[model samples]
Target: MAATHDAFTTGKDDGDLRRRNIQTHEKANGGMVYKIEAEDTKKLQKKSNLVAFLDEWEFVIAPLIFTALAFFTRMWRIGLSPIVTWDEAHFGKFGSHYLKREFYFDVHPPLGKMLVGLSGYIAGYNGSFEFKSGERYPEELNYTSMRVFNAFFGAVCIPLAYFTARELNFKRPTVWLVTLMVLCENSYATISRFILLDSMLLCFTFTTTLCWARFHRLQKESFSPEWFFWLFLTGLSIGCVCSVKWVGLFCTALVGLYTVEDLWNKFGDLKMPKVELASHVAARVVGLIVVPMLVYMFSFYLHFLILENSGPGDAQMSSLFQANLRGTEVGKNSPLEVAYGSKATLKNMGYGGGLLHSHVQTYPEGSNQQQVTCYHHKDANNDWFFYPNRDHMDFNPETADVKLVANNDVIRLIHAQTGRNLHSHTVPAPVTKADNEVSCYGNTTIGDDKDHWTIEVVNDAVSSDYSKIRTLTTAFRLRHTVLGCYLRAGNVNLPQWGFKQIETTCVKENKPKDVYTHWNVEAHWNDKLPPGEAKNYKSPFLRDFIHLNVAMMTSNNALVPDPDKQDDLASQYWQWPILNVGLRMCSWDDNTVKYFLLGNPIVYWGSTASLGAIALLILWYLIRWQRGYEELSQHDIDFIHYSAIYPVVGWFLHYLPFVAMARVTYVHHYYPALYFAILSAGFVMDWTTQKLGRRVRWSVYILLYAAVIGLFVLFKDIVFGMQGSHQQWRYLKWFDSWRIVDQ
Candidate 1:
């Protein structure tokens, strides 16, 4: 009897199972006929034990090696580059304060920094204990020690990821997929070892999620003690994370919701209802909410309780202020006395006189010049030192060609006076030196100079005569806007620099003053100025001021948006551009797979296809049922239902890129979205193939993936572009075309 491939049987007489194929005979016009024999199946029947062994071990050993490699990558240059990032400075200071005393008024809680500090402690350095009261060490070395601690935790997250996947009973291949993702993501890797709290935050978040999943899976059991313990642990870990950074409160809220769900799901079907429910809920409160909150508050109180021991005139900084204090003799002054011997004396230096005893300095009523205190001072004893008390000097007029140099020990002011460059070295002794003849500061107005565009003004003040002057004395300084620098100012002949016009309503002496700066430049410079006035401008100060004022003109020809048309800003907020800007800033070469494989542009498009697949599957199921086809078993039904969830889950996963790339500045936020997206994709593939017949399903899946990839490639060039060309795009304020500083 003939047999199909699956049902075919072979016996001792049969050479091979493959040789049992049906044969056909072909005949010519002649009476003789030739019969075709079945093909030999020697190669098909051959199997190597060594190859089989290698295949069996590949899954188990490959991931182990890959995970180790990932660990090494994370630790590659652990403390090699130890510069203190901005966030680290704050966090480390907070930690040091917490370790010393407690009770700090910091915006973030201390646990994350505490954990981070632990690494430095372990690395054979203790920043908290090392520096004495009033001493400052190299912040770079301190930051390195702190980062080493964080890097260890960051590397450990790899295994924690494996444990979370294990909770899902993820296959070896899937575990490898997730491990590789966690290992290689640039955002994750960068923040993982960063001295700030993101690494611990992510670990706690993943742990919390894993616990919740486990509790969900164990639903049938009556409220078990173990479940409650897990709920408590999750809350505790998350609480610790929250105590480190207030941002983690977001994850804490999610954990709270999960705790309630875990409680209800466990005790919902109780016959002895109300009392038991109340009791269980109360237990969850004590164990999860109260205990965890204690941990969180403890971390805060820990920081709050610490006292700030360092002061401006502390012994460590006493050397910096010693020369200034030395110039003025006091009864207590002695050669043997330390720079700042007593804490009481150092504290006295910062004491400002009472308001009633304060002296008020006013600008001249008829003067066009702005009166500002010059903070630079000259000391007789120390010629090149900045005097602390007499540092209160004032800026009397708008001067061109002013050069100011300030260092830790001294202040050097160089200016062109009477057409000869003069230098005033303050601090120890005052000395004036004429070094050059032509002043660097010219009398040409910003836009009027034409060749000398005031690209930007770092600081400026309003003159009493209503003219703007650039000077270091200005506090709460205005930053200028630049667009190839024919700055926005009224007259190019007047001195001008780019200054972003900001409306500031400030109250002083109970009176409100409204202030505004230039934001745009007009289209026709000639039309705005009086006839014959454009050519005679000689003052550089006037030219610079006019150049800045010209930036405020309202014209379509200007590169900057018109103030009237700026209803919707295409740029990010002045203070924060990370989200509005591209991901280029935090990107690293290490996590290319994480950046490209999941929640990437391709994944977003895949989510759309996943939805389409769900719809098609629903229709297929309905038709099969209507035709009275065989009923799908519970397993099949469950598989299909869960499979249907993939599209929604996948869609939700894509929201992270939007949050991280568009809405939020932080990079680690992408993890939750990536985790769910990859999870849904795996499930969708499994269920679709199991139910729809695997023969052609993979082909469809590949095509969908390919199509998405093609779209991303096209968009990548048109939208994101290469990082090197970021200057051309000028996504951020600092990114000017003619920028001289390193990005």
Candidate 2:
């Protein structure tokens, strides 16, 4: 009776459990249980959303901290060491001129000065022609004020960089890294601390590129009005850049080129018919090429119209009037005369004129000197071609008159009295009272030497008298007079009389034999000669000597003779771009501290290396073979494209002032080449981030990139700043010394 009772209880328990299971299954099928779980799922969904929010916060929060850090870095000691650099002094002088209604030479485009002038006007500097002594403003409007103005622009660049990085879809870490580097870069930092146009130009260019990248990235989105808006902004920024410098043309060119390339690639993949492809190409040309150019032109037109209406106070100008006033207009010549100088009145003085004139040195009287004939025979009808050079003519040096004959010596004479070359010790016939009407020889000295008509070296005052002489109007003037530049009067007149002859002695085979009379050849005379074999004519002996010196330098051996200046990169490295005040910052006064910024070998080399890395990355992405492996997400790719293309191209474009300086001297050309190199580093870091991110985890990639940057920073410190003071080194490379303290 007890066993039976226990079984009945067990059976009852089983039946109750079965009934519970069946009820649960039925509720699930009816969506009742699901409804209950849905409540739990809603809680879970809320929790998941919270987790995602937290993750995003963690990711972006660090970058925000970094951004704040960058801001402080730029702002810290902003005006603490507001010493004016050489460029600052130049710009400051120009700003003062704007107040005085005095126009300085427009070596740089008008936009940068316009911005500086605006700053001056705000500080009560009106465009007044009031000052006679050149002191345009009172003490309040000094370099300090200008520096403060620069600081404002500097601050603006930080946010611009952030926007640029963000548009590129740069990872949080990448954005932070770029921001930090830009804020800390000595070049950008140093430029920002003074009233110079470079920083401002950079800001405008960066902003434009940012806008362009943003527009390109948003083009695929459903409601892509952002693309058009950004495109307009890009146009404006480009205009602003061009207003500051003509190089901005390249910025637009790069954009147009990129757009076309992208269109071709995208459409080519779709396998469209030939006619459709052509139509597509035409459409792309309209959208990317024509539209962007129209936008750029329109921006300029706005400036043009504004200047036209606003009268004298308007800073925005096309400089059409100024350009016309300054005489950029070239009078139209007959086609025959343009291609080949008309020999209608040719007498014994007949020579190949126009751009094709062969400029050969005439043998000086008395000595049997071999004439260095420049083979520059370019036919007007036929294109130029290659030719083998015959042996040099052995001139009888003992004779008073040098009779040069061919086939004996290595140097051959191709023609007589071609053109004047100062380095070649050749001088052309000077302007005479008869030829004084021509402006080409306006500053040349002319004297009639009894029987021998000789041109004497006279002051410019005397040269003007000779230039005004209508009788001696020499027609077959060398193109050097028109296109080739000449030496500055100041350079010709050495300030320190005792330091007249700066010798660059070339030690050949371990013995100093052949010497370059002027150590600064560019400073002494203009190097304007027609294209010829002599273009690449470096003395073989000199080349070998330089090679030996460079080898020693690269090996850490002292190459330069100066023990006191042993810290110079020249002493340890014989490189193309010499690191000294003589080459890099030629316009700056050598005695000043700013001179150190010039002729810096390490910085130039570093920059070059950076460019190499950038080119490699660009090539990697551009070519089909490498593109697949080095593929970047579209957003990242656009960023890479802008950063890689604009900066490098802009380096050349914005370098007009420096390139212009090259016509006057050699030093100003350094910045373009050097900056190209430095900006290249930024591109490399960016490319590496993309590359590493694709293969590994993003965190690991970020850490690795940072480590590489750290290594680069180390290299910059140790290698580039070898002789500099620790403070100066840090200040120059990394703008914030507090970073060192923080570290």
Candidate 3:
């Protein structure tokens, strides 16, 4: 009976345990379901918030999307060519030179090259590639990164144009139009996608213009921090643009004119005090003039600091300047005194003209004497020995004390190797037929009257004291006593047969203003002075900068190609606006990558028509105002007349200036002006559409946008460096002057 009772109690205990376990499991499953529902609700809220934020800033977001697209288009396949194109060959090499700390000479300032170098350095480029034209980039080089950097900056112009248009108070459609205009322009796309300075220049130019426009808009709120910041940035960008190319000066001038106009308007605000006007003047002087000047100088300082080693550009500088550079032949702190019988090189004071040079090659056509030419290089042919009015007189260093050659002394210069006395006569020069020919003659110890030259120290007041004449420091004129002519290094290049050097001639006219007659002893080699120890040497940055500008200006002036010379790619300023020609960036067969820089026909032509329409509108407004038959609201006057005129003036400043330039300008040169032209067009659209109905305006905008997009599609391959067939290219070539031949 006891065993039966124990079994029943154990059964009851097991039943209770099973029921509690089931209840706990059911509660756990229900809690999990509740947690999942809470998570889903939070996610839905986050997504909704994001959608609302996007809707709130749709206009801003849209432009950003467009900018990203522009960037994508510019950066895509930028490295496809894998070789330098156009000026990339030059600018890339300069960048490599900067990376290696090797100095070089270029027509433009060093900031652009420095930026390129910095980009390559950041991209892990080792500066090992030669960057030669048509040469493939080595496998180890990071050429793509440099190209991408340029494209990135180039892409910034799209959004910048959008914002600039907005600042001008254009409608949303006009702003979008300006953005698309820059984004779809093939020339901008092509140039920016390469490793060239134009993209950088354009980026900085747009930045400057945008900053100035912002600053101008805030002119009423003087002393505001935002205004000051924009003003400062404007100055900074101006320095950067000018640092890239002199074409930036036009942008700087635009800002300057705007500043002047702003001040004049303020002056008319008689409510403002004279003290406040003075303050405004001071602020602009600091921002526009002082700040840019400082930045410009600092750029040059950085340039000189980075290029510490002597390089190919050493010969272009002064002896003193070269002496300061490391690895140069001229020792720093070396005595620069000149002595008779010392071999020396005489450089013309005239910019970029070469040293006094004589070679074995005689004048083939006239005089038949050894050619005395100005060779803008350092060669043994440029060496000459100074003598005491004799054909051959050597000063014995050991036997006699050192005698420095002084002013107003009759001296004869003999070609060191040929042993011929410097002679000038009545024979006409090879190129400048009006001037007398200068050559080397009379190899004997004594020379004829033709070789005699009186050394007249320039600005010396005919001093009799010979002790005051310094060799390198003093400027002198070599006047032929018998012929009554001055030795001149005329800026005329000899024929290719004469080695393409500058012609040294004798001019009969004694015009005091003729700077070509001035000469200075540049590099002197003498055994008398003790050699100085090498130490740290620093060159005067301001002086060197000025000298560099003068040299660049002179060289640039000489580089203008003849218009009669047939170059298929060359186009004049007048032809540029009409799209008369296009430049070829690269040409390859169907199997390889190709690029042709041509503008979108619809955008370019439309903008051109819009510009003409703007002109007519301005004329019509002026006539109506004179007749007192027209009334305009303040908003219309500001947005249409005043604001619209800024871009027109900007277009004139950039485009019209090129008309006076004699340089070999191409279609790409007009790009900066093209930006303004597009802006002017957008402004005109905004002004005209103000009076139109919504549907008509929207239809016009849609058609205009559709045209831009269609044209972009048609030219996308060329702009993006895609492979295309010769026949396809031929079909795209709308003008007979467009040479799209396969290479």
Best by lDDT: 3
TM-score per candidate = 0.45, 0.47, 0.85
Query: Rank by lDDT, descending?
Result: 3, 2, 1
| Model 3 Cα lDDT, one tens digit per residue, 162-202 | 77776776666777888898898988888898888888889
Model 1 Cα lDDT, one tens digit per residue, 1-743: 01111111111223343344422222233323222331233333343344345445654575577568556655555554323433556566655543443323333445776675566556544455433322234654455556656766666666666545444444333444445445544445555555667677667656655665455444445468766766677667767656655445555555565556656665766675788778778866876678777887666444323322322211211111222222222112222111101110110010110000000221222121111111111112111111111122342223322222121212111111211111111111101111111111211111112112121222222223212211111111112111121111111111111122110111111111111212111001111222221112121333322322222221111233334453221333221212222232222223221111112334433333555566677788889989998678875664454334432443353342344433323234444444444445444554444434333654655565455445434333222213333333233223232121125
TM-score of 1: 0.45
Q: Model 2, 1-743: lDDT tens per residue? A: 11111111101123345447656776768856665555655765676677556545644564466556544544444443324444555676666655554434334545677667767777675544232222223454444555557666665666666555555554444455455555544444444555678666766767766676666666554125554566567666766766665555556665666666766676766665677567546754554456655554553333333332222221111111222212111111111111011111110111111111122222333121222211112222111111111211232223324221111111111121321112211233121111111111100122111101111112121123322111112111111122232111111111122122111111112111111110110000011212111112222323322332232222222111333333222211222233333212212222323322332233444455666677776776678545466446775565566666656665555444343331222333243334434445555655564435343545654674565446445434321223323344444444221222112
What's the ranking of the predictions by TM-score, best on top?
3, 2, 1
Candidates 2 and 3, the one with greater lDDT: 3
